[model samples]
Target: MTISAFQDYLNEHRDRLLADLVEACSIPSVSGQMDACEQMAAWVEARLQRLGASVTRWETEGGPPIIWGVLGEGSASILSYSHYDVQPADPLDLWQSPPFEPSVREGKLYARGVSDDKGDLMARIHAVEMYQALHGTLPLVFKFFVEGEEEVGSPHLAPVAQAHADELKSDGCLWEAGEVDEHGRYTMYLGVKGIQYLELRVRGADTDLHSAYAPMVINPAWRLVQALNTIKAPDDRITIDGFMEHVRPPTPAEEALVERIPFDGQALRSRWGLRSWLNDMDDREALRQFVFAPTCTICGLRSGFIDAGTKTVLPSQAFVKLDFRLVPDLTPELVVELLRAHLDRRGFHDIEIVPLSSLSSSKADPESPFVRKVIAVATEVYGHEPVVYPSHGGSGPMYPLASGLGMDSVTVGVGYTGSNLHAPNENIRLEDYFNNVLFLARLLQSYAGA
Candidate 1:
């Protein structure tokens, strides 16, 4: 489609398109919320049906169901991976308006999942609709794997993927869309880092005791803190005992691709109200670390009397939640095993390790035909060379569907630096959203067109 025709289409259907997106985003389909998630599954299944695809709903072991749909037909197929579920809208007061209520202001749409997955999902569907309206039939077959548990680490996806590996097989997979950076340049990521989320707990006495007894009693909080201190140093390095041994280093090709990525560390630091990045690494080096380094981050810590007011009470129990970001060859199971051994060696075997969730990392070959075509098409459509990353710092369930099924994957999206994903006031530029729809439509046409 020509630029003029694209503009004309937008002019003719902008309001209705935005309305449809807003309607989908209005569903409180927060992941891990069983009741609301069930509602989202039903709505998503109906949406796919409306698109004229035969849909299948697979219920997760104990979470939301995975909605799979397929349409069009050809030897070449692209599996679209997206999530109907969203992160919980906590700290509600931080939002300018209600998160579920899509708010448009200053040429941006503010909603919880607008920039993350919903906008991308809707844009892809819009592209499908617009493509069919203009081209009659899709150039290649398309499969949809819109799951309802992506926001929660996709714990149940592995089982489903193993059970239906044949159905999910595809020529290439279109993972979630990547974001435009702070510089307003389009970006693409070939892979995502995996994650191992676990909690560490320590116990002292069975009940809380008076502070006066602190001299005689051992405080579980101190013990937990000490154990955590061993995991990371003040220099921000993940000193997890023997954990770094498993992280696979970047290949020469990966290094070359990563070097091309723009690094505006100062801009990011300014936006985050900071003076310097961790360890004061230069912007480029910090960017490399962000992508390549494995991390043992303490997400949360809780113990005694930690409230609005001060209370001198000895805690019986202490807990610290940690998330370990894994690169290639470093599975969640390995990290857990190493951590247990490390703690045991350090004489802290009493501390229990409770795993919450995990997803393993997978990367696509930069020179793959799929990656090359995506790069070429993105350049043609976006009017600029796209910045490519070998791996995104974020973790997702892409492994089960991408490389696990023997296909490469990439991200294409409408997010900008200020999208605030997983934070309050998440948003996407209205212009970017429309532009992505056009790009996706072009992408659909750029294939072999057999």
Candidate 2:
């Protein structure tokens, strides 16, 4: 179980791993694209079977199946979570190459799902393969759980995990999508924020009316804007009735962890061409908000006359897509209840609240044995101390699968700062991919022996 043996195996099989990744990425498994998702699921099932895993495809009510597999037998077991489905590669013109065609350029592999979760998935599989090759048997029991609906907020993940809790329970879970920071330091996140995505719709008239009728007719667009304005104040505080009451401030230890996190606000401001952050907060305050504060964002807005030219017509209906990033103690169900009550109380009862998708937040103790093991292995593999984030700002289904199952989860991946996740030209460095194989191998060895 030495590092050199793992490295030797990776060196010998690097090309094969890359080829497998390319094949996996070639499938256009966009979240809602059932045909492609099924194709990708079949590919995963075949691959896992080839690696001697017992595979099961769990069918969702209306979504793609979840590919679950178990391999090897050991005293300790570990669950690896990743998703095969990717975000739709829209705005195709932005891509330098086709989204599904995996291409290697400048030592990086570029594809729609290459870096987000597919690459991570492939790396873990390769790690298991390499470990078995050298040790004659896997160091620990390994479980692979790859879902196809993560890009759509994993609407059914909670129920699926609950139903299969017995099978998914493990000593620790390895989450998807970790990355190297801009400073070339590998980073790990213990948990992720929760999200509540919903849309507010309003209607005023039966159909479009001439602009001249605006003086008499109530405009739904204007009404929607007024209602949106009430949810957040000009000071960037979420004024959704009772929303702030659920946002608990970071504990003293959490604050100390935040202080340790390296942040360069100036670099971010320069990259985004911004003069300052919201409310011009100082570095510590900004970092605190970045990791702790909940957000109210308008993801999309729609109404009549939104094309190239203005159609001088009054809009009959309006809708706004909103996402609320929740902190600890704030559940998605609570968000919907509070928002509906808030809108109704503000006399905008006509505005409909349609809950799109949601999942609760997840957090792990940084000092937990599982997290400490990850930090130690990452440090050894990267040859430097890894940047540790108590919790990532993004929302994911980590809660139900990890913390909810009474397991600690840590994220690790083959991405860098410029991986362009969920955007065009998503990619990961080949070196990082190979290095992660070694990292996972060592983690498995260490965990098994512990």
Candidate 3:
């Protein structure tokens, strides 16, 4: 199929597609909120049904429904992965308008879930519709594994994936994450880093004490500071033993792909308000660290007060939120065990480590046939060579489809860089959304033939 023909299809049916997406985007499907979660699952199921796919709402014990759909018949199936949930629109006051009320401004749609997985899901569905409209049937068989608990770490996902692994088998899977960079160039992430999140709390006295008693009473804030120091030193290297044992070094091909990734390190640092990365690293080194190296970060720390002024009270309890980015072969359970063991050895066992959530790292061969097909289609439709990466810095459940199912999965979406994902005023460019529909359509057509 010609790119012009696909573009024509998008132009002809753009209004209907946007309307459907707008309706879906209006739902505040924050995964943490159960009601909106179920609503979105049903919405997706209904959309898939309308697209003539046999739909199933796979209910889990405590998680949101996993909407499944199938179309056409082929031994080699394309497993399309996406989520129907979003992060909570906290700090709601920062939003330009209400988070749930979808609004179109300056050729961009503004809402919490607009540019996130919702827009992505709509683009995939629209692509399928475009193919069916052009041809009586899709070029190849496909299925969707849309989950609602992605925002909440997908705790119950592996269980469901394990249970339905046979039925969900496919030649490959394309999990949804986000779209290209700010320049509209096609971007693909083959993998993502694993994560281990925890909260460390230290108890001091039975109750809050005045600062005058500091000499006699122990301060939990100081205790937390000392404990955090043990995990990561001034040089920023994590001190947890065996933390780097399972880390797999990048392959030669992966290294070559990293060199090809055009990242303006200075620009990125400026955008994120960083003076410079640790060790004064250059572009290649910084980029390598971003994709390959593991890290320990202090997300937040809660302790004594200084709000509006200083009311001196030694807080009885202090908590520190921490996250450890793990490389390949580094399981979350292993990282947690190492941290616990280190703390116990260091005599800080009193400091509790409450586990939060974790997502595994994944890496797909950069030159795999499926990956090449994705690149070819993206280049043809977008009129630019796609940016190829061995893995992504962010963590998502992309591992299950690629590493779990042994498929060369890739991620591309309508999401624009600096879309403020998971933050207030999340949105997508109007043109990006339009082009995304054409991209997916061409990809489906090309892959089917491949």
Candidate 4:
């Protein structure tokens, strides 16, 4: 089938497609909200059914449902993964419009989930429909694996993938999200880093103490600060004993790829309101560290007397949330073990380690057939050559379903650098949405022919 015919169909139904996306985004399917998540899943199930897909809704034990849909029939099949859940739109005052109320301004659609996953999900659906309408039948089988718990670290996806291995296997998988960089080059990622999110707690006195007792009382807040300092050094390197030994260095090929990546450090610094990157590294070093190095990040910290007013009370207990972004060979269990031992050796056994959630890192060969095909199709669609990343800095549940299954996955979506993902006024450009539909249509055709 001709690509223009598919593009024409999408153009003709552009209004309806936008309406569908707006409807999908209107549901505030925040990750932990059971009612909203269920409603969104039902809506997706019905929409898939209407598009002639045989849908199966798998109910999770404590998490939301996993909507699996299969459509068309052919020897070749493609698995597409997306999520219906969104990050909580907290600090609502920052939003110009209600987070659940979809609004478009200056050619961009704004909503909490508009850019993260819903936009990518709806664009793929529209592409499939457009392809079928133009060709009279789907060229290959297409599977939709939309989950409702991705925003919460996809806590249930690994087990679900194991249970449905036979059905979930595919020739290749298209990951949830991607973006066109500020330089107009579409970006594709082959894998993601791993995550170990945890918390450290310390308790001293039974209750808050007066300033007069500060010299006698062991302040938990001070203990937390000392413990945090031990994890990272002044040079911005992880100082957790034995933690760096597990971080697998990038291969020669991976290092070469990073060198070729177009990283505008000045632009990034300006956007972040920073004078320089970590350790005042240049573009090449900064990009290398970003893609290959594991990190110890302090996500949040809390204790008493954090309010606006000043109080002379000393906090009895203190806690801090930390996330360790792991590279290859560094598993979450290993991190926890290393951290516990490190703290014990430092005589900080009074501090407690609370492991929250984790996901292992995943990577795919950038030169694989499926990956090359995606790069080729993206080049043809976007005109400019696509910027390929061997692995993204962010972490996701890509390991269990993609790498663990011995299948390669690549990320492709309809977002731009300006898309305020996980923040207020999250949005995507209208033009990018249409372009992504066309890109997906062409990708389907190309993969089917191959």
Candidate 5:
């Protein structure tokens, strides 16, 4: 079909397209909520089938099903990946509306997965539908693998990727989740950093003791604080042994791009309600470290206290959640090994190291021809210069795409900066939603024209 015809079709059915997206978003497909996982997958499968593609629900013994759909017949196929699931909605009271209700207010559609993933997935589907309605066929071959476990660390995706490597083969694959910059500039990202998430626990007394016995019984919370101190210094530099050993220095090209990137540290701090970054990380250094350096973060902590007022009780156990963001060439396994060694060497072998999730890093060359196509299309749609990220700070299951399928992945979507991703009041602007539909349509048409 022709691009103009497809655009006309999309505009003619704009309301219908928006309604379909809303219906899909209405499904509460939180992967953590196991029962809803299957329902969401079924909805996606049906939607793809309605779009004239053959659908398959690839099943795992205990994991949620992986929905797949295919269209057209060509050697060059685009593999589009998205997640049907979303993070659990906690702190419910903070939401302006019920998360699952899917309401529109002030030009924003409020829902848990609206911007994070479901919106992006719907855009591609709508694009395909528009082209089919116009020309009775797609511009290129297409395949979609919508996963159900992204919010929960994507534990089952590796096995799924390995098992269906040949079936999922394609010339290029787009990562599921992404967002525009604070200045309303469209940005395309290639690959993501690796991650090692672990929880540390310290034990002291056998049971909780009263305040009067504070001097006699040891405090596990204090011990946890002390251990955290050993892990990261006041300046945020990780003191863990061998943590920085595998860091690959930025290439001359990457360094030059870093210099070109317009990073406003003061603006970022104001957005996050912070006075300054840790250790006075100014604009240039902050952007450089965000892209290149590894990190150690304490996500959460638990200890003893009172319900309403202060209760001085020496807690028996204290727990802390730690995450390490890794750069290229550093696997999660190696980070864990180094963490264990660091603790053992520090004479704190008693502290338990419980792993939560580990993902290896993934990256693609920003200067590649395929990457330029992505940037060009994004700019055409958004009417702004698209920022090309060599690699983002977040972690995803993109390693297999880069290593197993031998294809670079790019993340481009309509999510705005204030979408409150993975948090309450999550939303996407109405304009972005419509723009994304146009972007996907133009992207598919670009290949045909090329």
Candidate 6:
């Protein structure tokens, strides 16, 4: 099918397609809300049904359902991975309108999961309808692997993937979504960093003690701080014993890709109300560090007397939530091993380490044929060359479905720079949403040789 034909079909059904998106986004499928997730999954299943696809609902003991559907007909098959679950629409008062009630203002659609994933998910679904209407049935096998628990680390996805490994086999995968940068350039990511989220705890006396006995009574808060110091230096280096030894430096090709990425550090600093980046790194260095560096961050901390009024007492418990972003060679299990050893070697065995969630790092060959094809089609459809990232700094469950399944994946979505993902006032540009529909349709045509 011609691009204009696709464009005309989109133009004809623009309102209806957008209404479908709004309807999908209307479901408050916040991760962990199984009922809402089921509703959203059913919404997706019905669309697949309309396309005459056979759908399967994979359910486990405690996690949300994994919706799998297959449609189209061709020698080649492609997998599209997305999640109906979204981050909680927290701090509710910050939203101009209700989080689930999608509203359009200033050419942008605002709602809680709109830009993050729902928009991308519906875009792919609508693409099938658009293609089938303009052409006949799709010229390629279209597979949908929409899961319901991505926001909470996708803890169940790994096992679900192994259980249904045969059904997931595909040529390549289109990851959740890509972005349109501030310069109006469409961007794609080949891989994502892995993550290890855990918590550290320390204890002092059995209960709160009067500060007057401070000479003898231990403060767990103070003890926790001392232990945390051993992990990272003031220079921001991860000083955990032997932790840096596991990091794998970027390849020459990856470095070349980073060099092509656009950076505006001053603008960022202005926007964030910061004088400079950590250690005063320049734009290029900051960007490189973002994509290549593994981070040890303290996400949250809780101790005694955090309330407004001061209390002169020592508490018995203290804990801190830690998030470690991993790079190549840094598996979540490996991190746990190294951390346990580090704390033990430092004679801080009393400090407890609680493992929360783990995700393995995954990457694909940027020069792969499937990747090259997607990029070419993106450039053709978006009228701009797509900026290719060798690996995104963010963490995701892409490992289980992409590299874990021996398939390359690319992230090209209906998101933009101001999408406000995982934050209040999340939104997506209507133009980008419509363009994504056209882009996915063309991608199918290119893959199927239609």
Q: Tell me the whole-model lDDT of each prediction, alpha carbons only.
A: 0.87, 0.90, 0.84, 0.90, 0.82, 0.90
In candidate 1, what are the lDDT values of residues 79-138, reduced to their tens digit?
899998898889999999999999999999999999878998998888888777776778
Pairwise lDDT winner, candidates 1 and 5: 1
Model 4 misplacement above 4 A: 90-94, 209-219, 303-315
Clashes of each: 4, 0, 0, 0, 0, 1
Cα deviation of 49, candidate 2, in Å: 1.7
Order the numbered candidates by TM-score, best leading: 6, 2, 4, 3, 1, 5
lDDT of 4: 0.90
Model 5, span 1-450: residue lDDT tens:
445665677668878877887898888888777789889999999999988889998887687988999996655578898989988878899999999898989988999899878999998898777666655677578888888988877888888888889888777787776677778777777778999999998888788788687787778888778878888887888888877778888777667667867777888789789987777777788888888888888898999884897876778889999889988767889888888898888788878889888999887776666667777888777787677667788888888755457787889676888899989999998878777777787787775553
Give the least accurate 10-residue stretch of model 3, judged by summed lDDT. Answer: 177-186
Q: Of the pair 3 and 5, which is ahead by TM-score?
A: 3
- For 405-434, candidate 4 gives per-residue lDDT tens digits of 888999989999999999988999999999
lDDT per residue (tens digit) for residues 236-290 in model 2: 9999888889887777766767878889889988999999888889877888887
Instruction: Supply candidate 2's per-residue lDDT for 289.
Output: 83
Query: How far out, in Å, is residue 121 in model 6?
Result: 0.9
- lDDT of model 5 at position 12: 82
Backbone clashes in candidate 1 total: 4
Q: Which stretches of candidate 1 lie over 4 Å from their true place?
A: 1-8, 32-36, 90-98, 208-219, 305-315
lDDT at residue 68 of model 4 (Cα atoms) = 93
Q: Residue 155 error for model 5, in Å?
A: 1.9
